[model samples]
Target: MFARWVQEILRSPLLRPGIRSGHRTSGIFVPVVRGSSAAGKIALLERGIILSSVAYLAFETYKWKKGQTVVHASIKVDDIIEQADYLYGSGETAKLYELLSQYKDSNDAELLWRLARAARDMALVSTTPQDEKKRLIYESFDSAKKALELNELCWAAHKWYSICLSNVGDYEGIKTKIGNAYIVKEHLERAKELNPKDATTIHIIGVWCYMFADLPWYQVKIASALFGTPPSATFEEALEYFLQAEEVDPNFYSKNLLFLGKTYLKLKNKSLALDWLTKAKDFPARTEEDIEAMVYVRYWYI
Candidate 1:
């Protein structure tokens, strides 16, 4: 029976490594950390014995009648955070809201916050060009503010609020909300200082830097000459950060080759720019239906 259990464990993929791949911990082992978990320890011991016996039975069943063998189901990405990757995009709200509304047994406030955010983004993208940007920013900011009303404490949603405020903060009275897009850097830094392991917070800091830093050296020099507050140009630095972000999660960004081509051109490397231009023409993120894409392809590339 013991040998059968070992054999069953050897045959089971779950017993080897999990979805994490490199850092896999077997679920069957229950570590005794301290004296606080009396019931837990007892339960662990009981489960260990039962599990081994079950494994033996499973192996025997596998040999005799495969239908009687027990198996553990694999966890899907959707199970952990429903449509989690879509959280980055503006189109995920309706589906998320429908799921949230149907989940009556849920007490998860974070889920509610995400649903609200998605709805707000939908409103932002659907508005007319004249009022769309500002209106969407306000709509999303208001949704995030409701997290507190929904009895939820969400620092992440608050961060999104700050992003929205920055995006549409060009008007006179509302300019104070985001004094400069650079303020987001400090906020994200604070979040990172508070939680060193928070990848999302770190990513946002990179984003803030990229947006503010890549505003064109000539334009910035001109602004500084006139406005007397020239922020140092860091396009190379911004590029580095964006590259890091892309490395962290390649699937998050829709193809953005056009920007890369333009960036290379801005740096005055026509050869590299032409190569990137060719690549950009094939990217799926070319939303603008202008000759700009092919023009670059022909002028510099051909």
Candidate 2:
């Protein structure tokens, strides 16, 4: 049946259009005369069949090789997430977000927390419109929330949730932001307690303390009145956390040095402030925040 089909296609009128073989005078291949014998037409059909078979096989082989290449290069979910984490560490938030956003609906707690962190970081340095920033922050919060729902004991999930909430707090009203700030502290403390060696969490706690400490007296009074003794820290308290974080992981983040500098200035130690800020200025810029911190250090120094 297959052979008959091939014969039919080869002998089809479309392919059999007087395909003359050679120039009679020069004996070179050219269309000069039509076939005059039955045998000649049969030979032409046979040659067409052979050529068609070769062409079909060649096409099929090409497609098979292409398919094999795709199969070999395909990545597993774990491998993809691992690569995304590397991108995240390098401060490539856009690439990290692009790689992990496809897993937003995933139930895996680890993946969710990573996605949340990526979204939060992306929003922090985002140059987009206010609405887009809000969207990214909310998305970060949502992903972190989902991760905690799946496994509340996961320290990274809690940490990422707190970080996302902090970002969300910026757009919220003063009362709400103050309340969220306390929650952020709570989660950071929990994260630190869960993993004492985690320098990032310790650094975040230091940053949290520094932010509240630097708040103006009037806002402090308002927050105290509203929340009934809101969480507050002095530059001294902030410095301790920052130093502890440094002890655990030296120079883990450029912002840590920047914050240390700012905290010292707040404490009325100008010389120490200048020293720390100088170090921050010299630190290699890894992220947008790092570059911003460098600019801040120079501006304050001048």
Candidate 3:
């Protein structure tokens, strides 16, 4: 209430003209009215001081209120993220995608990254035609790119950018796909550097290494013909990343466990492969990936 009153005084049109009329400057002066007494001048000075104090207090109060508003907004954003995460974790991919898509134009980096990831996962699990799947993947890439533009320090943005980039790579020609593969690795590495303890990022780096290592000879030949020998990796490299991911967050994602098991099998460690595969098989088949992991485990162990 007091703030509004002071603001009214500061913004009042009549107050400004009256104050300006009494002012004296270096190069110009306005003489006092003929019959104005010294006491009147003193009273005018006191009023000016009071007005100044009130204006200062009002400005400070406005700043405090603005700060409180920001804090509340931040809390609201956190709540939204928590709800989205629960939906995504519970395998409600379509709903999660729709929920986050409403915030496509949001400037918040965390929200943008989550939206990108939701889009990418939706594309992965979608049984739609190739064109629609590709469109969703591209949307994921664009959202991740926007998140990075908004905040370069957002590790999740880099992580999802790498994932969406790889998804888009599936449609590219061999040469272009190989180039995108390198870029995918670079982003994954950056994400790992920024968030070394992020199990998902670590698992993705392992997947990146595994995909390139497991590429068919024909694809490699095509890439080599188009570009001077493309980069190559080994199952050993993949195993290291997967192991690191497990160390950080053991069995967090069934897919991560499946990858660890598959990498171990590829590396000729049947015992370790069996151990990880069994864990993946027993992991509650909650999400699509978990169900897929169960199928793979049956195919391998049964």
RMSD of each: 18.7, 27.2, 26.1
List per-prediction Cα lDDT, in the order shown: 0.41, 0.65, 0.65
Report the C-alpha lDDT of model 3 over 1-302, residue by residue, as the tens digit: 54344335445565443221111000100001111122333454454345443332322232234333112223355556655655543445666676677678889999998988777666654355667768887898889989999998888888777776666666665555677777878887998899898877777678777877888888788878877778788899989988898788666667777888888889899999999999898986433345545666776574
Work out the TM-score per prediction.
0.47, 0.71, 0.70
lDDT for 193 (candidate 2): 85
Q: Give the range where candidate 2 is weakest over 10 consecutive residues by summed lDDT.
A: 22-31
Runs with alpha carbons beyond 4 Å of true place in candidate 2: 1-76
Q: Model 2 Cα displacement at 293 (Å)?
A: 1.5
Error of 1 at 214 (Å): 5.0
lDDT of 2 by residue, 1-302 (tens): 54344335445466433311111110110001111122333454454345443332322232224333212223445655555544543445566676667679989888898888777656554255667768987998999999999998888888878777766666777787777777888887887888787777887788777777778789889988998888778788889998997788676556778888888888889898888888888876433444545666776573
C-alpha lDDT of residue 197 in model 2 = 78
Which is the leading candidate under TM-score? 2
Which of candidates 1 and 2 is the stronger one according to TM-score? 2
Using TM-score, rank the candidates from best to worst. Answer: 2, 3, 1
Candidate 1's C-alpha runs over 4 A off are 1-109, 126-136, 145-155, 170-178, 188-231, 284-302
Instruction: Write the residue-wise lDDT of candidate 1 on 1-302 in tens digits.
Output: 54354335344565333111011110111100111122333454454344444333322222224533232333222342333223222223344433333322334545544544453444433223646545644655555555534542455554554444454454433234224444555544554565544434444555454444566566566656655774343556545544554454442322223444555666687787676567655433211111233334445555
Model 3 deviation from native, Cα RMSD in Å: 26.1
